[model samples]
Structure formats: C-alpha cells, structure tokens
Target: MSRILIVDDEPHLRLLYETELRRAGFETMTASNAVQGLEFVETMEPDLVILDIRMAGMDGIEAMQHIMERDQRVPVILNTAFSSYKDNYLTWAADAYLTKSSDVTELVETVKQVLEKQATAHG
Candidate 1:
C-alpha cells in the first residue's frame, strides 16, 4: 500500500482529504503545519505528500525545499487554495500543483498518477 502524507493547517480539509484518499486505496497521514509535515517526511517517509501553501507558518514551498533536500524521491503535490502560486518559481519543485476544491476527484487522480509514475521510475 502506498502511504501519502497530507500537510495542511485546516483540520477539516485534512480529514476530508484523508477520507477521500483512503477510499481511493492510498494510506494517508496528516500534519497540521509544515514543521510536522517535514518531520513526518523524515521519520515516516511517505510515498507522496499533498501540501497546502497558505499555512500559518513555514509555507509549503519552503517546506518543499526542505523535503527535497532530504529526499527528492518522495513526490510532492502542492494542494493550495490559491492558483497564484502556480506562477511562483518555487512551486516548480513540486511534482504537481493542484488547486483545492470542494470535489476531490482531480486531487485523487493526480495522487494516483504521481504515485504510479514515481513507482515506475524507481522500479
């Protein structure tokens, strides 16, 4: 089973994403901030990460830089409410950038695709 880490400040959004991803057959873990997210990445080493940009402290882009420094192999999906960050050069490091939505269909699909692609590349 592929384990995915969800990094977001919003508890409800985390739960929603966790539930949706779990239903899609991916194991999910969540962190409320970038610090926790990076710690989980170091300790748990999830297959992929769904990161939110506009958090309380140490935004997703900054956390992503740290995560990449630790393990570039772990793919990151930037899950932000703002589309403006898509133009930000820092977001380029993310494997994919997804704008948050009430419907998580696209998010789930992106997760599957990224995990599958990364698996194929590694194998």
Candidate 2:
C-alpha cells in the first residue's frame, strides 16, 4: 500500500482526508502544519503528499520547495480552499492541484491518479 502524508492546518480536514484515504486502501499520515509535514516527508518518506497552500507558519508553496529540494521524486498534490493559488506559478511544481470541497471523491481519485503517474515515471 502507498503511504500518503496529508498536510493541512484544519483538524477536521486532516481527519476527513485520513479516513477517506484509508478507506481507499491507502496508508495515511496527517500533519497539522507545513513544519510537521516537512518532517514527515524526510522521516516517513511517504509515496505522495496532499499539501494545503495556506497554513499557519510556512505556506505550502515554500514547503513544497523544501520538499522538492529534499526529494524531488515524491509527488505533491496541492489541495487548497482558495483557487486563486492555482494562478501562482509556484503551484505548478506540484504533481496535481485541486480546490477543496466537502466531497472527497475528487481528492481520492486525484490521489490514485497522481500515485499511478508517479509509479510509471519512476519505473
């Protein structure tokens, strides 16, 4: 099973994503902020990351830069409540980008697609 690290400031989102991803047969980990998420990226070495653009301390864009520097191979999915971030060029570094919604079906599908694409690229 693929391990996914979900980085978001919202506690509810973290739990929601974790529950849904687990149901999708994935191993999930949650980090409340970009700082913790970065640590998980280095220590846990998750197969994929679902990152939120806006957080308390370091934003996801900066965090994504650090994550890529540490390991470019790990794919990141930018999940944000604000669609405006998509216009920013920095977000392009992520493997996938999606606006947040109450329904998690899109999130789950995107996760599978990103993971599959990463697997293909690595192989």
Candidate 3:
C-alpha cells in the first residue's frame, strides 16, 4: 500500500482527509505543521505528500522546497484553500496543486493519478 502524508493546520481537515484516503486504501500519516511533515518525509518516506499552503509556521511552499531538496522523487500535492499560490514558482516544485474543498473527490483522484504516474515511472 502507498503511504501518504497529510500536512494541515486544521485538525478537522486532517481527520477528514485521513478518513477519506484510508477508505480509498491508502496508508495515511498526519502532520499538523510543516516541521512535523518534513520530519515524516525523512523518517517515514511516504510515497506522496498532501500539503496545505497556509499553516502556522513554515508554509507549504517552503515545505515543498525543503522536501524537494531531500528527495525530488517524492511527489507532493500542494492542497491549499487559496489558489493564488498556484502562480508562485516555489509551488511548482510540487507535482500537483489543488484548491481545498469540503468535497474530497478531486483530492482522491489526484492522489491516485500521481501515485500511478510514480509507479509507472519507477516500474
């Protein structure tokens, strides 16, 4: 099973994502902030990372930079409430950028697509 790390400041959002992704058959990990998320990247080495752009401290853009520096192969999805970050070059480091929504259909589809692409490339 593919492991995905979800980094978001909102506890409810994290829980929602975790429940949905798990139901989709993904092994999920949760981190409340970028710092913890990065640590998970180093230790857990998740297949993909779902990140929120706006957080308490190190934002998703910054986290993407650090994550890429560590392992460019790991695909990151910049899941944010704001779409303006899409214009920022820093966010380009991520494989995908998604606007947050209460409905997680898009999020689930994107995760499947990215993970499939990764598997194909590495296969």
Candidate 4:
C-alpha cells in the first residue's frame, strides 16, 4: 500500500488528514511538529509526506530540506495557511505546495498526482 506522512501542529488537522487518507486507501502516519516529523521520516519511511509550512520550531521549509537530505527521491507536499508563504516555497526542495483552504478532494488529488508522477520517474 502507498504510505503517507502528515505533519501538522493542529491536532484536528492531523486527525482529519489521517482519517481522510486512510479512507482513500493509503497507509497513513502522523507527526504533530517538525521535530517529530524528522523522526517519522527516519522510521516510518512514508512514500509521501504532507507537511504544514507554519509550525512552532522547524517550519515545513526546514523540514523539507532535512528530509531531502535523507531521501532525495521521496515527495514532500507543503501546505500553509498563509498565502505569503507560497511565494517562498519554490526555493525549498518540496515537491508541491497548496493552500490549506484548498478542498479536500484537491489535496487528495495532488497527493496522488505527486506520488504517481514520482513513482513513474523513479521506476
């Protein structure tokens, strides 16, 4: 099964995402903050990561950078509540970026697109 790691500081966000991804037939994992996220990347070995850009300590950009260093091929999708952050996401190695207000269907589609595209390239 395809695996996904969701990193969000908001408890509800994590739960909602986890539930949604699970219902979509993806094996899901969660990390509440970037610190915990790094650990999950090392241990959970998720095929894709849905990361929140605005976090307490290590933001999504920094987390994406670190994750890239560990596994350059894995796709990391960055999401943020603030529109301003969208402009700066290109500098990071994140595979994709979308606003939090984006519809759940869009989010799911984006994730599938990214992973399928990556898998095609990798395979």
CA lDDT, every model vs. true structure: 0.93, 0.93, 0.92, 0.85
- Compute each candidate's TM-score over C-alphas: 0.96, 0.97, 0.96, 0.93
Off by over 4 Å in 1: none
- lDDT (10s digit) by residue, model 2, range 1-123: 999999999999999999999999999999999999999998999999999999989999999989888735788999999999989999998999999999999999999999888888779
lDDT, residue 82, model 2: 96
Off by over 4 Å in 4: 89-92
Q: Candidate 4: lDDT over CA atoms?
A: 0.85
lDDT of 4 at 88: 78
User: Candidate 4 at residue 115, lDDT?
Assistant: 88
Give residue 74's lDDT in candidate 3 (0 to 100): 87
Report how far residue 113 has shifted in candidate 1, in Å: 0.4
lDDT of 4 by residue, 1-123 (tens): 899999999998898888888888999999999999989888878899999988999888888888888735678998778778766745356778888863677788899999899988989
